[model samples]
Target: MPLINSDTNNVNNRGAFILFEGCDKAGKSTQAKKLFEYLKNNGHSVELWKFPDRKTTIGQIINEYLANDKDLDDKAIHLLFSVNRWECRKDMKNLLLSGTTLIVDRYAYSGVSYSVAKGLDLDWCCSSDRGLLSPDIIFFMDLTAEAAEKRGGFGEERYEKKSLQEKRIVESSLKLIENCNQLPLKEDLWKTT
Candidate 1:
């Protein structure tokens, strides 16, 4: 028998990992879905995943807390959301290896941003997403809180309150991109004053 080449055996023609990031009501989801459909129609096998999937077991806990006013501690809910993504990580890798393009609505960045925005440890947030496949292209849909709130029902979720979101969006944008780049200097990803 011929010697097996480990590189060839492991190498797969994965398409790409595309990610969209933004604050709440920034139209990131709408744009992500549109991009996914467009890619699908172009004969590309594609998959869509949203962070805190909120359907898985861990996500269910997060969903209950966010939606039902359940008494889960802040850190607990934050970690549950992080675990939710970790649980699906295998499938995420498998799909990418199977030549399917992944159009993720939100990914580790949002997890870090939103979690750290709540005064949790930024380093902890960054560490939670360690080892996740880096995105081929990351698109950040920029929007202002004033404009976003005008879209209606912005205060529906636990983190969607106007004051908190505005503060987090501003604070987290710079920190999030800094973490994304792992750079010493913080860069603002979203264009807001």
Candidate 2:
């Protein structure tokens, strides 16, 4: 993978904010953790962060919603997802300013894309996440819906199913890449042994 450094005005120059985004079972968490471990092992400061943290109040609601245990309005859930990230904004900025790289499993892109797939207004979804920290480099794991379905945990969560909806989510994710630096990862490169 190509590692792209960030250009920032922070006193310490700040650390790179790297993000991994893709459909369910696309190995975002796995690759993010691996990158975090690699950076740490090399004596660099690094952190691995995931969305819907499931530990905070907002995240708990998100967790329940994802599990299909609780029903939520589309706008409500979308805002909650954005709020979940906002809750971490301070700490994220602090870590980066302190020169610690962050390997994130997901971010605003997922929130906007998934919600938009459900027929929400794209502008509205994007508005909720304004002023969030943007990633210095985003790695889009380009996995087809068919390929993702064959992986484990394909149908356990609300968004894991392979369908036309998921295809749209994947397509929507591409929209976020246009103005940002991208490092595309082919499926073969991410396959587990």
Name every residue pair that clashes in candidate 1: none
Per-residue lDDT over 85-128 for candidate 1, one digit per residue giving the tens place of the 0 to 100 score: 77987787677666788999877777777777788887766666
List residue ranges in candidate 1 displaced over 4 A.
Answer: 1-12, 183-193
Best by lDDT: 2
Steric overlap count per candidate:
0, 0
Q: Which segments of candidate 2 are over 4 A away from where they belong?
A: 1-13, 179-193
RMSD of 2: 7.9
lDDT of 1: 0.73
lDDT of 2: 0.77
Q: Tens digit of lDDT per residue, candidate 2, span 25-84?
A: 778888898888899999999988999788999999999999999999999999999899
Score residue 31 of candidate 1 by CA lDDT: 92
